[model samples]
Target: MSKVILITGGSSGIGKSVGNFLTKKGYTVFGTSRFPEKYPQSNFPIIRMDVTKPNSVTEAVASVIEKAGRLDVLINNAGVGITGPIEELPDSEIQKNFETNFFGPIRVIKAVLPVMREQQAGLIINVTSIAGYMGLPYRGIYSASKGALELLTEAFRMEISNFNIAMTNVAPGDFATNIASGRYHAPVLENSPYKQAYGNTLKLMDTHVNQGKDPLEMAKAIYKIINTPKPKVHYKVGEFMQKFSVVLKRVLPDKVYEKLLMNHYKL
Candidate 1:
């Protein structure tokens, strides 16, 4: 029997690519997004959902259960990004980001755990980012969100292993996606506290994301991990640069790492 996989934030970017790829591989793919009506009704069905909304998550899961009877895997790929000096961003902006990036995945997991626990088998893949491990300038909020996600996944992995559930966290480096352009940006001009502190740094980081790894490559990496017999707890996907970054983060002193990031982003 074909396995059933559900993906969140499947309307575009890596989520959409994974949905398309998995469906091609014969998995019964059910993707969720707030704008399901915009996604064509096809083999990879798109269901209406907002990760930050509990009701939406519940409804999406219920719909998939009714149709598929069982869900074999879940890809928690739905997330949002916000960039700027932490102090400069409005309190609401930070909360909004955490709500979408962190709590969003939690919501989906809660809605899916019951079925998986009962079946005593399932897999969850969290689409985290390198920023989850190494912090970046003007990205304190983004880092915080993913960092929390990484820790949450760890706790979840430990808690659910006994239930025969597997969890994998994919930490991809910079990818060329709409996430950079689509991020929530707050104006830096008006009397913001950290306007001057983050002005140039934000610009440089934005430029880097504008030209990064291809999103399709990320999608392929995700597909491989999903099909693994015993999926690992974490997978890092990126080019040579990303590997080097990880190494430097571990070997270099704190000041040295900071200097490298400062030079990379021209901070």
Candidate 2:
């Protein structure tokens, strides 16, 4: 039987790309969407799931298990983006981000644990971001949310290892996706102290996304990981510099790295 793969947030962006690629590889792929009606043309079926809600997660998992009889892989690709000066961003937006980007993935993972344990063999891939590796200016909340998920995945891996259920976190750099359009952006206030810096930084971030690498790169990387018998705890996919930035933080002194970031962002 073809392996069954379930991807959350598969309606578009990286999730959709990965789902389409896996489908072409002959896998039985199922993608999840909060609004399944919007993606009637999706190659594979899309299950309705709101990772923030427990009931939705339960129903989505049950639907997958019922249709596939088993789930061989799960790609936790559902996430939202948030950007603003830390002090300026509303608490509600931050909470919402953590809900979708951090808690959301955890909710889905918990829902699938029992089923995977029963199978004795399963793979879980958490789609994190390269930003998670470091706290970027004006994107602290996003970085924190993803970083939390990354650490949680590490802890979860140790617990699930004995169950023959493998889990890994894949961090991708900027990919050409609709995330910028959906992400919340705190207005650049005219009289706020951070107006100038925030405005310039926001423009830069958007430019980076606009010129980001193709989503196909992420899709290919994920496909390769799926076929492996033993996947690493973490995988990073992106341009040389974006991936290297993570390494630089490790080797550089604290102040030096901060200076580099400030310089990069022109803070």
Candidate 3:
């Protein structure tokens, strides 16, 4: 039987691309969306899921297992982007971002762990972001949320390794997606000190995203990860410079790295 794969946020963007690619490769793929009925018809199935809600997550995973009898892969790709100066972002907004970007994966992972443990073999891929590696101006909360998820994936991998389960954190750079349009912009109060800086940085960030790499490239990387035995714990998918920047941050002097980041974002 073909492998059964479940991808969150599969209605669009990177998750959708990955689901379609895997389906073409003969895998039984189910993509999750809060509103599955709204998406255009496709070969793979759409499962209703809202990762933030525990019951929703549980039901979605159960539905997949009921139909497929087994789940070989789980891709935690549902995430949201929030932008603005750290101080200007309201507490509730930050919580909402974390709910979707960090805790959402946690909920899904928890829901699927039991079945995967019983099977004694499964692959879990958490889709993170390059921004997680370094704090980005006007996007600190989003970066922090992804960073938290990355750390959790790293720690969870070690715990689950003995069960014959594999986990990988895939940190992708900017991709040409509708994420920018959906991003929550923190309200900048009139006369807020960071308003101008936030505007300039946000503009630069949007430009970078508009010119970002294609989502298909990320899907290809994910396809390879699914096929490979003993895939690495972490995969960085994006332009050479963006991937290299992660390495540079590790080796470069603190001040130098900070300056480079500031210049890149025009902060």
Best by TM-score: 2
TM-score of 3: 0.98
Candidate 3 per-residue C-alpha lDDT over 136-219 given as tens digits, one digit per residue, 9 for 90 to 100: 778899999999999999899998889898999999998998899889987666798987788888788889899999999999
Query: Against the hidden reference, what TM-scores do the models get?
Result: 0.94, 0.99, 0.98
User: Per-residue error at 187 for model 2, in Å?
Assistant: 0.4
Residue by residue across 55-174, what tens digits does model 2's lDDT show? 999999999999989999999999999999999999999999999999999999999999999999899999999999999999999999999999999999999889999999999999
Q: How high is the CA lDDT of each candidate model?
A: 0.86, 0.95, 0.92
| Candidate 2 vs 3: which has more TM-score | 2
- Candidate 2, residue 35: CA error in Å? 0.4
> Which regions of candidate 3 are displaced past 4 Å?
188-190
lDDT of 1 by residue, 83-196 (tens): 877766899989999999999999999999999999999999998888888887788889989989998999999888899999989988877778877788767776766667
The 10-residue segment with the lowest total lDDT in model 1? 189-198
After superposition, candidate 1 runs with Cα above 4 Å error: 41-43, 190-197
lDDT of 3: 0.92
Model 2 weakest lDDT span, ten residues long? 226-235
Compute the lDDT of residue 267 as modeled in candidate 3.
70
Off by over 4 Å in 2: none
Error of 2 at 134 (Å): 0.7
